[model samples]
Target: MTPPEAALDTRGTKPPAVLSCPQITTLRHRADFLRAARALRQGTQGMLVQARCRRDNDPTIRVGYTCSKKIGNAVTRNRAKRRLRSVAAEVLTEKARPGWDYVLVGRPGVTVNRDYTDLLGDLNYALRKLHAGQDQ
Candidate 1:
């Protein structure tokens, strides 16, 4: 087998192909999060998920994560947000639809302690529920 560096012919020649997942951007503005809040929502044991489909034809998935003060002090809230971010990175990269915005609200006591697999399932279930509601 060739060495790792040999795999990349980076001498002004064509670069080796890099395999990567599609890019997913974050929702930074308050207005974007508010817009999702006005759309469909589903709550689970660990989180509340809100999703909104945008009218524009952008083909990128946007996500936001929030943990209220009710969750705890700054440190605890930060920890919850971190966990929410990880879950989003794992679940949304594959499951989320493009041209949509999603907001994941962290639960006070459960978000930081819930099992990772359960959290993933909760997000999947919530998204399905939200979409199903829109069909009605």
Candidate 2:
């Protein structure tokens, strides 16, 4: 008979020891968001993306999400932010450059209601535009 620990089927059950890509960080400071505000911006049907390259050599990407009160009451604003966060995580984790900060601003009518695929496309498109503008 096999030992208890050896009896378990662990073929595809083991978790990865390490992630392929570096993990992303969240921007929580007011100064960081303010600084990104002065950087390149691209607006899509769903949301606005603001990106700023940092001087440091950190390999982690930082992101922030915000929605104005004009979007609606507290519930509405939170929903918009939640959608933005999901889209950012999906799109920015692979595509966004390191040593940069990005902020996703929620639009009143478009953010919470837009299709998920369209939101992802918008974020990808916005990032491309922001980077292309930087190279010029």
Candidate 3:
């Protein structure tokens, strides 16, 4: 028996494959995340953070995503990660400072249900709040 071919060829898509932005990764290095948690400025809403900071040699801002087991099952966690990644792309591309890194930690409710535009707005608002906090 022959193997089935994919329904849609990969080439037809636009420049960015869903995962290529590279901003959304787990916060692997303990020190980096610690620095982000400590020295880095932060902002929050009903969700979690939309944070930013400058790092030497890191020319572009990167993002890390998280959702604890309490959030849901595997399918729900994956969906939340995807939504956060998409939002992080919009935040990094548009509002985020160039030399910063972001880490978006998901809250318990509505993370998957929130409107995309509103998610973007929350990210923007959070970044602005973080910056404002920096000034004072």
Candidate 4:
């Protein structure tokens, strides 16, 4: 047999992301939580969303994304969360306010062939809905 060849292993298993959308709670609220509650939330989306009223001193919000094993195997779940994280960084970087913690949970249909713009739009819409509830 010849020496092993080196190439981009597209077939290689994808790795889980280092960033995760951690569950937000009142006790966990620190000085640096970024306030995306008003923006990253949308009740109409029919997704589970919980928020804390406390504020933090950090200038940027900490965000995490989760995909349960039900979504698929380790690879599928990791891919979904990674996509969410990339979109979060691209669109929510400057958009999300400081002092709040945000997390996004993937729905069954969330992993479809959707574009980043569509994801961002959904996020924006949800955020508006969340803020509307705050007004009432």
The candidate maximizing TM-score is: 2
Off-target runs (Cα >4 Å) in candidate 3 are 1-28, 40-46, 50-52, 55-57, 133-136
Per-model C-alpha lDDT, please?
0.88, 0.89, 0.68, 0.54
Error of 4 at 37 (Å): 11
Error of 1 at 46 (Å): 0.5
Off by over 4 Å in 2: 1-18, 133-136
lDDT of 3 by residue, 1-136 (tens): 5445535556786443454333434456756665666654444443577454654755466677778887789888888889988887767676666567667877667677788888888878787777774532
Clashes by residue pair, model 1: none
Off by over 4 Å in 1: 1-21, 133-136
TM-score to true structure, per model: 0.81, 0.83, 0.68, 0.57
116 Cα displacement, candidate 1 (Å) = 1.3
**Which tens-of-lDDT digit does each residue in 82-125 have in candidate 1?**
98999999888877877889999999999998999999999989
Candidate 4 on 20-101: residue-level lDDT in tens? Answer: 4333222234332334344344442323333333344544455656667777888777777777667666655545545555
- Model 3 compared with the native: what TM-score? 0.68
Number of the predicted model whose lDDT against the real structure is largest = 2
Lowest summed lDDT window (length 10), candidate 3? 16-25
